[model samples]
Target: MGRLSTHILDTSNGRPAKGVRIELFALEGDKRHPVATEMTNADGRTDAPLMTGATFRTGTFELLFHVGEYFRSFGAPLSDPPFLDVVPIRFSIAEPDGHYHVPLLVSPWSYSTYRGS
Candidate 1:
């Protein structure tokens, strides 16, 4: 069975980025449709897979991470307008039954992501 999952790590804090907001979107042509909105738990991961089973498909998608709000909540010293605010990661799924783990390592200043196991 194929599934989509994600997690956030606060590289600056050396811990999971708890309570960050994540928005999922499915892109079709030039339009983006909202799929789901999830928040990171204590482990900096969603409670369940973002997409699975019938809901999971091979197509283009985007994951929007609200890192600015997350840093502010913890009193991180950032400029009036944070350098890295809402981080948008756009990717595509090619296999119908492959697990896609997109994990984000981020901070108020910068961020990175990759296709994990």
Candidate 2:
């Protein structure tokens, strides 16, 4: 069965965005429903996958990162109306039995994500 998991790193600090908020949502039609909410640990990983086992389904999902707050808390200089606010990562799970790794390498001005093995 498929599972949902994520990791968040602070590219600005070259460390895990500890305590950064992460929200998981399952996209249905045009509405997004909350699956779970968690904060990154010292290792930048959630205590558990948002969902796992047979309950996982193939659909679009979103991971909302509180990058603005994360940077501000660390006293990163901003340009008054930061360039990167909340980062929304939208992707689809094509296989229920496949392992999906969506890791976010984020900075104040930019971010990147890909389908990791």
Candidate 3:
């Protein structure tokens, strides 16, 4: 399971998105503040889990993915106004003590994310 950490995969290229910038935010009273920032490794995972054991909290959170730039860097051709631009995946951490795996399988035109192992 993802546990306190998580991973993402680019299905378009069949590899991890190394160096991709990832930002995590906590949604609070209409104000979103940066909670953490990291880059995906060669395995499309962060060097450390987004949430550590001591501070895993239950609340609404957001992940901003620079998909357009990521695809372009990989040399993936896109149409004149690419279908998918910056993608924002939002979810809730219902249980802080449990592991959470949110994996993204993405492409230029489409994408999918779910609670993963």
Candidate 4:
């Protein structure tokens, strides 16, 4: 079965980012449809796969990570307007039956992501 999953790491603090809000969206051309909203757990992972089974399909998708709010809660010394607010990672999936792991390594000022196992 195919599935989509994600996790976040607080690069600044060198730990799993817990309680971060993540939003999933499916994109079609100029349209973006809401898919799922999830919160990272203690392990920086969602309780369940964001997309799985029949809902998992091949196409473009976006994962929005609310890192600014998370940093503020932890009292990170961010600027009045943080350099990195809501981080958006957009990518495409070509194989419907392949497991796709998208992990975000983020800080108050920067973030990066890549397709993982």
Candidate 5:
């Protein structure tokens, strides 16, 4: 069975981005329906997959990561309007039965992500 999961790595600190807020939404037309909200664990991963098996759908979805506050908590010097604040990752589950591991490697000024296992 396949599932959807994500994790965050603070590239600046070289550690897991623990305690960062994350929100998941299902996008339809011009509306975004809330699906799930979770915080990164000590290991930088959510306690559970965002979606799994019977509940996983194939379509557009979005993951919003609140990164500015996270960096501020660590006292990173950033502009009033941080370069990277609400990092939004939009993707599609072309194959719902295939595991989708979307991991984010981020810093105050940059971020990257890719599909994994």
Candidate 6:
């Protein structure tokens, strides 16, 4: 019953971060392997769950959000080294039967995520 999903909210703009690029990586020891890459829709969500059913596993995984590029696309003036560029969220799923709704609330200066329903 477990599934992996994510969404991005652009806190600075008070809207969903549409068209944002997201990457999924499975971690193993010292390195990580790419699982999939996707671009957010108008609602800042993928058309399908990142992982679900049999493909979902109990292990550490990383979700990388390309925030800097997203903001820049809107003509937001950022620092030379943007305050927040690629935001990476690393998490572990111990329950294969649990739902992991990793939602991100982000802005040019900061971001946050949590296990959601």
lDDT of each: 0.96, 0.86, 0.79, 0.95, 0.93, 0.93
Q: Look at candidate 4 and give me any clashing residue pairs.
A: none
Which window of ten consecutive residues has the lowest lDDT sum in model 2?
48-57
TM-score to native of every candidate shown: 0.98, 0.92, 0.88, 0.98, 0.96, 0.97
Instruction: Write one digit per residue (lDDT tens) for candidate 5, span 4-117.
Output: 999999999999999999999999999999999999999999999999978788999999999998999879989999999999999998886889999999999999999987
Displacement of residue 37 (Cα, Å) in model 5 is 0.2
**Candidate 4 global lDDT:** 0.95
Best by lDDT: 1
Task: State which candidate, 1 or 4, has the greater TM-score.
Answer: 1
Better of 1 and 5 by lDDT: 1
lDDT tens digits, residue span 34-93, model 4: 999999999999999999998999999999999999999979999989988899999999
Query: Model 1, range 59-109, lDDT digits (tens) per residue?
Result: 999999999999999799999889989999999999999999999999888
Maximum-TM-score candidate: 1
Candidate 1: which stretches are off by over 4 Å?
none
TM-score of 6: 0.97
Listed per candidate, the RMSD to the true structure in angstroms reads: 0.5, 1.2, 2.1, 0.6, 0.9, 0.8
Kindly provide the TM-score of model 1 when superposed on the true structure, using C-alpha atoms: 0.98
Higher-scoring candidate on TM-score, 1 or 6: 1
Candidate 6 Cα deviation (angstroms), residue 64: 0.5
lDDT of 2 by residue, 71-109 (tens): 898799987899987899999999878888888999898
- TM-score: the better of candidates 2 and 3: 2
lDDT of 1 at 37: 96
Residue pairs clashing, model 5: none
Report the Cα lDDT for candidate 5. Answer: 0.93
